[model samples]
Target: MTTVRAGGRLRPPDTRGAHRDAPLPAPPVSRRRGLSSSRVAGWGFLAPVVAYLCAFYLYPLYRNVDLSVRHYTVRSFVQGGAEFTGWDNFRQVLQDPSFGTALRNTMVFTLVSIVFQYAFGLALAVFFHRGFRLAPTLRALFLIPWLLPLIVSASTWSWMLNSESGVVNYALHLVGVGRVDWLTSPSWALTSVIIANIWIGIPFNLVILHSGLQNIPAELYEAAALDGANGRQQFWRITFPLLRPVSAITLLLGLIYTLKVFDLIWITTKGGPGDSSTTLATWSYRLGFGSLLPEFGRGAAVGNLLILIALAFGLVYVRVQRRQTT
Candidate 1:
């Protein structure tokens, strides 16, 4: 440290450098105006995306809400006519037999998919979190199912699970377990669809959970080990608790995606073997476009219901996030 001689006595060094090195003052008014202009330009660049969402997502959503409260049919679709029916459409769809089946199927499918996906994903994430030979390659390979397009995956699975001569039933027979119809049967159709969904979703869960696991500090695990904590204990008390945010997002996204799944179910069973596997999305399509005479109002009503459920889940996610921050 430097010293200064003041009045012939040795004195401490000048310490004003800290303050001298402080941040500069705010920019000039003209520069501030430039920043405002930049922000406007940034938003201007986003104008097309904003307009696109409004034109497609928002407008379609608004129409769905409107259609839910109206009487819309083939005539209405063709000739542009709809009469406001208040809650009649909602009531009718809610009371309909197929709607109940769809609701049940949706709940079962969503819950089962989420459970198996998260469980298997978490296991893989934890397993692969540690460094190992070929870890990256194996992890990348696991993502193939998720990367495959829904329609292609569905068709491939359809062939694999064909009741008469599919590879799945063939394997079962080879093992003396007897052939089982993977689809086309009312009892097994939903199960088959759920299985495909679970398989397709596992990669997503694995990636997300693995990333979350990685974000956790290694120091915590070292401390836990020093404390004589076992792997399971450390996971529950340390890993799981710390990974809450990522888990929340993963589950939320899974739920949203699972709730709106259409192509998988459509290509697999078409909500069929007598509507046994019908979820809200499939059921809505069935009403609006699958029938001889489209029940557009009913379809819209179901869609709105599904949307409301999704909004509820979103609200829950927001609350959980807020709590986490607090």
Candidate 2:
């Protein structure tokens, strides 16, 4: 027998286990080192995103604000030492004759586009949620408008709505209605752009609203049906109430998007017919780049107004959401 240490007490070693000695376990890994390495890796992944936002978003916004405050001529824009006029640029923008027209058009275009887009989108989403035959295929087809490039869509509308040889006039002629000058006449130019914008926007609403509908439990509808609720009643009581959050967000997004719609209006009518179709967006572009003499300061001021409008609506949304949650 040989002495062995057991719990700090002397004991004789077992004869059967005397030939084998258990080795001590390896030391545990250092948690502090592992955590520090993981933190470094996380920062490495985040650096690119932070840099991109600073470069593209924050830097441009700062420059725009700077441009708005300073009276910069083409020479001064390229060179340095532009005069800082403070709110004079904004005042000029507000006092200009075209400002009223642009403001009115902006309001009409934004409100009309958002209302029709939401209405049509919500209708389509509800219809498609029924899951009828070929519904999936039809829903995908509706997304074509949203998927196409904005330029292509605008150009297509221009061709279709051409006064001389367009399909729309031809179709109207078949029904004995005279051809209406869509893009040219001041009276109809804004209306024409609004129609095109409405068409382009509906699909976005449909996709978002449909996703919201999917999250609603089907049992609620079944329960309503079992309670002798009619289709309209069920929709009003169950569907609409549940879809309120989605509708709010959809409308907010639509409002923001429609407010800055420049491409379609520009490509189709170039905001033409003597500022009839000109919105704040087109007006800003026209001031900055559309004309021979660019008013960079005034243009930046108008652009800032648009930004402020969007920001106001965004704040309202956040407040409303907070209230709902609380």
Residues 57-135, candidate 2: write the lDDT tens digits: 8999999999999999899999979999999999999999999999999999999999999999999999999999999
| Residue 270 lDDT in candidate 2 | 90
Each candidate's TM vs. the true structure?
Answer: 0.87, 0.88
lDDT scores in order: 0.92, 0.95
Where is model 1 more than 4 Å wrong at Cα?
A: 1-32
User: For candidate 2, what is the lDDT?
Assistant: 0.95
Clashes of each: 0, 0
Best by lDDT: 2
For candidate 1, write residues 226-293 as lDDT tens digits. Answer: 99999999999999999889998899889988999999999989998898899999999999899798
Error of 2 at 323 (Å): 4.7
Model 1 scores a TM of: 0.87
Error of 2 at 67 (Å): 1.2
